[model samples]
Target: MDKNAATDAAAETPTQDTAQEPPLAGRVALVAGATRGAGRALAVELGRAGATVYVTGRTTRERASEVGRTTETIEETGELVTAAGGTGIAVPTDHLDEDQVRTLVGRIEREQGRLDILVNDLWGGEHLLVGSVFGKRSWETPLADGLRILELGVRSHVITAALALPLLVRSDAPLHVEVTDGTAAFNRRYRENLYYDLAKNAPIRIAFGLGEELKEYGGMAVAVTPGFLRSEQMLAHFGVTEENWRDVIARQPDFAIAESPHYLARAVAALAADPARASRWNGKSTSSGELARVYGVRDVDGSRPDALAYFEEVRFSGKPGTPDDYR
Candidate 1:
């Protein structure tokens, strides 16, 4: 991912309640796929909230990796987490490999003894994008390829949670956050892509199913979606800088309703800190905008951009222009 993009986006917004108490000082957390995007930001935010975080991903300092786009190393994310005030452990892992995932969790269990939070963000869907589009139709795409996306996006989460369950079950306040796209019920156009939609929607099901299964264990599982995430790579894709991102709305109208990954990170941190969070959102798929409203946290610009609402009230209204015009 574009480190520059993240740096610029974060710099544009004033810091949030950094002086507040660290609510998760003793908590042990893990953010899978922490190399970039929402996962990377969430790891740092958790650290800011005073939780030791294990940041795991395929990209590492030792070797150049192949998700084939801009890459962020696990060590980089870990360092950011540490800088944010929580202990950060960089574990280079490919979640699709069950053995690798098991070993990673084993190490965490050995050292931490208990897992307080697990954020399953293992999406290597970049591989599925052939020239910025799905390679084939839903049925046309090779079943194996589709299955691979599901394995990385959904199954890896299950395997990691299964391996870490014993430790999580022992924690006083265990929480599982399944990072995903918009709600399955909402079902936007989704680029008319089949496999991508399935992969994106799978996490919602996983969150709900896991919530039901883990309820007896006193754990909560909820899926979350970020707004039109203005990632470094995305900014580059739209040919805009964070300082001038508002201008991109002229071309890609939806860009006006963007949120930095850190916005979602803050939301996740807030939810994790709330002792009654599970009771409020267990088994639900929520958006960053919705969470911001519930928790009263602001985005990077100190504004709570209710992008979901914009989509519903404006984009869905069959207006003459695209989402960007509203900005």
Candidate 2:
């Protein structure tokens, strides 16, 4: 048996949502690439909403993933979920490997028997990736690397969807979230480099394609982005802790509107629990801040930082403004 397989453990009810039992109680979710950042937080949030989440990623205690940046592992993420009142199962999976991903889905079937939500938050394939890890001009990018990146960034997503389709369709109105770096509107401009731009935009396209296919089955798919995410890597790059992330604004004012990974988690949790209109967001590109308005969930700081709005109004407009301008 795969160490990742479950043992028919009893389901748990999230106690944090004091108003009532969590809407996702007894639900099962698979959060791919959940070792860190938005994926980690999203898995935790699903747990908080009373969902049994199988968290998969390459980073584990026994091995460091290609990200080479953090010790955060999928096991730690699962532990956090369990602590938050939902079941968390950790599975180290390399999404690019068809055999590994296939076995993962099979384990889920043997254990949980159903998969209700599928969040394709895959990344962390830089070493195995086809393109330059450092953003390079299209002409300058090595052809082999560029093609491999297409496999890592784009093909991995399709592989997951193709394999998970059977399990996902079993649930009523299953929700699939394809996490991307930017909204479709924002990615219209170049993003540092050609490969990077395409990689980011690919997820949105995947969501659109899946949205079209899933509609017939009464399921939904959407591309989601976090507003200027203060992910672990970003925070490390800025040389600040989440406790003092404000310090980064002095060097990069755009950082002022940065949101935690949990913000994206809130957006996902809200969508999953929305029994009435979650499908309305299908084929759309959304952010945690915008979804805050629809779902009424705030960031850890209790304010919704609309990063895209801030970028357009303050960054692109060449105007200086406080974070409040966006919040």
Candidate 3:
């Protein structure tokens, strides 16, 4: 179904359950940035498929990380994973610190013995996206701030994969998912900020770079992205909760195409289960909507909205029509 049809159907149905056997049973997975958003959702979804998930993040119930505005901690995400039926272990580690990340992986090796899936989702750079002339050229933005984005967003992914790839390669059919925003086709246009554009585009390149190395060991890596995600912090931005998010669509019609983190979560889960078809997606820059069409999984209230398609046609074109047709 298209985005609009799915959204309309969601409004009519209270719930849509697509039942399946636990495909990931006996598997082990790790999400490096499981504080919230895509990382948290990926952990829970993997658990739902019966994979023991190691969730790592800086935030805990005791103290918050740099993104301290919200209270959703890594411990909470781990608990949610366990509640969903798989073992969840929450380890507090600052991904920016290579030593801390190495130690965390060591613990996972000690406990799980093998790592089947690795999700490098450690993005804590949003706190530094500040400046009067933000989203300017590389020379325009503060040099330190721009480099800081590379440190938190790009370097952290490299560090986590550097340490974790060894263990992952030992597995039967390992999958590495590098989460980012916008697909390769969508991000070709300059995102305006040097750091912002680089940070977002690096993951796409990582998948291709890593895929070359991983091919030797029959391992795979792909950069994954969600459509406009209605994450917890995003909900707060529109001054509404998930329960009442539809209300904001009136003000910003494009909001109608926004999807929950679970959409991407399930997308990765589907990938983990279908390792035989790994070559089809290896090294590709993909999104939740692209996978949803293939897997037939549903999003919030079973609605499948494609934010990229809407953004490309409507948001980018500056069309003055409502999202009623698109989503």
Candidate with top lDDT is: 3
TM-score of every model versus the real structure: 0.87, 0.90, 0.91
What is the lDDT ranking, best to worst?
Answer: 3, 2, 1
TM-score-based ranking, best first? 3, 2, 1
Give one digit per residue, the lDDT tens place, for model 3 in 1-327: 566876775565323244754888899999999999889999999998889999999888888877765579989999999999889999998887889988988998998899999999888776677552255677877888888888888999999999999999999788899999889999988776878888999999999899888888888889989988998888987999989998998898778888899989987888888856467788888989888877767686677678887888777877665454544
Candidate 1: residue 204 lDDT (0-100): 87
Over 4 Å off, model 3: 1-21, 130-133, 317-322
Whichever of 2 and 3 has more lDDT, that candidate is 3
Evaluate all candidate structures by whole-model CA lDDT and list the values in order: 0.81, 0.83, 0.85
Task: Kindly list the per-residue Cα lDDT of model 1 for residues 108-195, writing each as its tens digit.
Answer: 9889888999999888676566743375677777777777777777788778878777778788767988998787556555745676
Candidate 3 global Cα RMSD = 3.3
Model 2, residue 264: what's the lDDT?
84
The residue-by-residue lDDT of candidate 2 on 1-327, one tens digit each, is: 122221211111112548788778999999998999999999999998899999999988988876785559889999999998899999889999999999999999999999999999997644533345465577887777777667767888989999998999898777889998889888777877666678889999888888888888788888999988998887887788999999888888778788999988987898888876445688888877788778767677666789987887777777877666786
Better of 2 and 3 by TM-score: 3
RMSD of each: 4.8, 7.9, 3.3
* Residue 307 error, candidate 2, Å: 0.5
